[model samples]
Target chain A: MSDSEDVLATAAAWRAAGEPVALATVVETWGSSPRPAGSRLAVSATGKLAGSVSGGCIEGAVADAAQQTMRTGSPQLLDFGISDERAWEVGLACGGKLKVFVEKLA
Target chain B: MTPALLAALQAAQAAKRPVALLTRLSDGEQCLWPDAALPGALAEAAEAALRDDAAANLTLDGEAWFVHPHNPPLRLIVVGAVHIAQALVPMAQTTGFAVTVVDPRRAWATADRFPGITLIHEWTDDAMRALAPDARTAVVTLTHDPKLDDPALDIALRSPCFYIGALGSRRTHAKRVARLAEMGHGEAAMARIRAPVGLDIAAVTAPEIALSILAEVVAARRGAALARRAAPAPAAAA
Candidate 1:
């Protein structure tokens, strides 16, 4: 995972340009997860992103979530708890649950 | 993307600093995972195998490992409530350190005394338990009292805090050595204790002493000592 400085810096630049940005943090993790709790990846309204929530599988979805947060100006808590249907979607073999907290900040 | 993250992580890793990433994953109003409860762990054994199917099966440890490219903060535990600690705390914070201070003395160990510090008004063990001191943690005990100093030294010697120092005069330090020996501490462990803490700067004031101590801590952290300027040919051995 990358440092938050770049993410914060870009977010500041976005704010200066009257663009919205969101910060996502993994406050807590359980079982076995790729990233530890407190990992952050920030996204801007312009689709600029820094850091990663998951190794790779989750960033695309998270970037999507970030854009949603930026547009609606509302935060979301996305869960990757595998459902029966989810089994066919992507191989989330790890039984550990990821409680991702996404938020937008001024 | 700014390479700041990689730079910071690489710098910290090279300097032997333990760094943790704090992300803002989701938030109310505008959030990534709204209603996301913090689980603190994730597991995916089946997914791992399936995903590997695409890129040739490779054995990977199922046990949770730190995410690649993620660098956590190094934890430094300062076990004294002294003036030197006051300055050192802020400096450590500025330089990207997760610092904690433990002291039982009421007058010395109060939150107000250390505004932004993770000041703990408890014994060393309790704080260490809650925080779980790691190898990247550096333990510095400044109080001369055995009550505050000894137990901390005990915990630090056993734990992985790279730098462990206790403040004392040479005589006081010698006495401390004797006491630890009496208490069944071996020489090897005692080696970890840096008595007469701080560099030999002959600092007489609090701030100066603070600078000396932190200078040593910085050096110890980087595994480099401030190179002493060349002496003038040693004066021909006097």
Candidate 2:
């Protein structure tokens, strides 16, 4: 199975175990995004992570957003561009732009 | 994401069925296409994305939605554990195909010979039938022996496998076709077999032959217009 499948399965397993979980998916990409649009990162309440939306560049931010989504029961659309200072601060200096949708698994 | 929806997606993937998950971005409402019976526009969008194995964001009725296509992993079932199989297995794996090598001869299909590979020490026909090659599956028979290769070709021709290749000389392929015909395979079914298999790249070595086969497999999968093989016959010795 591909890594995405493993991520989804991990997310499901965590949810089934009564752990709060959030899924962050790359909804769109521009230029040289490290991962494609469907790539996913599954984050659990206990700080466990499966898969990645980028090449270790912006996952920390996404995971942080995932935790926030889980706590607030709201979804978030995150946009990161190479030109954005916030993107650089998050280490997304990969010369690409990406939109990630983070939603708590209810 | 509802637990039910996530479980359904997992079930579809485990069953190797192609499905698309449609998400309403504005409200976080999600549904699996074909399962929930999407509207015409959404269905069309999902169909297109799934066909390309891509994910896209589209606005249907002025509402932004994400269509994520989930497809089964590609699989390759090789019906011979030969030297060429040795080369092709790793190449196919590198290309994201879960490969299985089948040969009844225990000596040839040993774990030592094919380390870390799925080895099926069964007759070709049985192994092919058990595998049940699907649209995402490719089957290649490398055993030049008719006893091994013919059974695989027969099973593969009847299946929905995306690609079926047989390694042999032109003369050998001709005989194989004749045998398949006598076994009730029609001309159209036989035509599906790319005999003297591989793109005609003038490949001479085993690894080169493996490369050509992998290239042709990718071409077939991507629906690329294949260049017809030039007449020197492939180096897959009969």
Most accurate candidate by DockQ:
2
TM-score for chain B of each model, two decimals? 0.65, 0.81
Clashing pairs in 2: none
Please identify model 1 stretches exceeding 4 Å from their true place: A1-106, B1-68, B225-238
Residues B80-138, model 2: lDDT tens digits: 89999999998888777888999998989989888999999888899999999988899
**Displacement of the residue B180 alpha carbon in candidate 1, Å:** 1.5
- Which prediction has the highest TM-score against the true structure? 2
Question: How much native contact recovery, as a fraction, does model 2 achieve?
Answer: 0.68
Candidate 1's DockQ: 0.09
DockQ of each: 0.09, 0.50
Off by over 4 Å in 2: B81-100, B106-134, B154-160, B164-238
